[model samples]
Target: GESVGLHLPTLSVQEGDNSIINCAYSNSASDYFIWYKQESGKGPQFIIDIRSNMDKRQGQRVTVLLNKTVKHLSLQIAATQPGDSAVYFCAEKKGSNYKLTFGKGTLLTVNP
Candidate 1:
């Protein structure tokens, strides 16, 4: 059986600090993982992605780490700012499937 979704987690951070959000996937067959950030009243936006073949991938002000051994994924945001506050989600897809299974999202709040 596969997990369809998860309970949302909340993360609070101070401005100028770093934030780390973690996600766990139930499907080990999933090869592609993507991170998305969604602001209030807006759709999810692409953040970063990593393949199972790679352990880590970096983007502007963001880093994604994948641990296939534990079916875990994490997103690290550098220099947390108020504008960076959003709900972040991790999505996984396997093979040629166009559908992505999304994990529980984490709401990040950056306080000044």
Candidate 2:
């Protein structure tokens, strides 16, 4: 995913814990959103997606919450592990346009 010019700092966590990541979007017309996970040396892989019509979406070990009013979004990760260490990203799409703007990436570090 493309970085939205601002790169979020990294987060380190212990194993068997939960992690929460947050982002703020600039566009109000964005109709679609997705969360992606990227491990070292790999591109981002889609984790989940939600539409403007919906406020929340979930996936295995992950949940996304969106607040259109504040243009805020967040991702929650359960069961922190060494393998879970990676970079996470949130992407948004505008109405009828396939172009996507990625939020600053967050690097998650899980301490075993």
Candidate 3:
């Protein structure tokens, strides 16, 4: 099935550096967006989210931006640490749908 995907399959960054992960979604009608970070064994943990009505939202040490014009979404992490290394994914829900279509995970590697 068609779904969202990241431009880069993996991102490499140094510790304490700001990390920006970009995602491209094909569905313009998707009204809700979420970013998740998954550790090696755990399930995806919600990092941040944004509604279509808004352009941007922020959480602790993280920010999610929604660009409806280009169907683009990005998650920015501040002061990224080695502990922040994980696979990140973006999911989108269209209308009132309960199921979220997720993008191919982007592996973030933080070098010390």
Number of the candidate with higher TM-score, 1 or 3: 3
Q: Give the local distance difference test score of model 1.
A: 0.89
The residue ranges of model 1 lying beyond 4 angstroms of the native Cα positions read 4-8
The residue pairs in collision within model 3 are none
Of the candidates shown, which would achieve the greatest lDDT relative to the real structure? 3
lDDT of 2 by residue, 17-90 (tens): 99988877878878888888999999999988989888888888988898889788888889988988888888
What C-alpha lDDT does candidate 2 achieve relative to the native structure? 0.83
Query: 1 or 3: which has the higher lDDT?
Result: 3
- A best-first ranking of the candidates according to their lDDT comes to 3, 1, 2
lDDT scores of the candidates, listed in order: 0.89, 0.83, 0.94
Deviation in angstroms for 109 in model 1?
0.3
Task: For candidate 2, give the lDDT of residue 72.
Answer: 80
Tens digit per residue, CA lDDT, model 1, 66-99? 8888778899999999999999999999889999
**How good is model 2 by TM-score?**
0.90
TM-score ranking of the models: 3, 1, 2
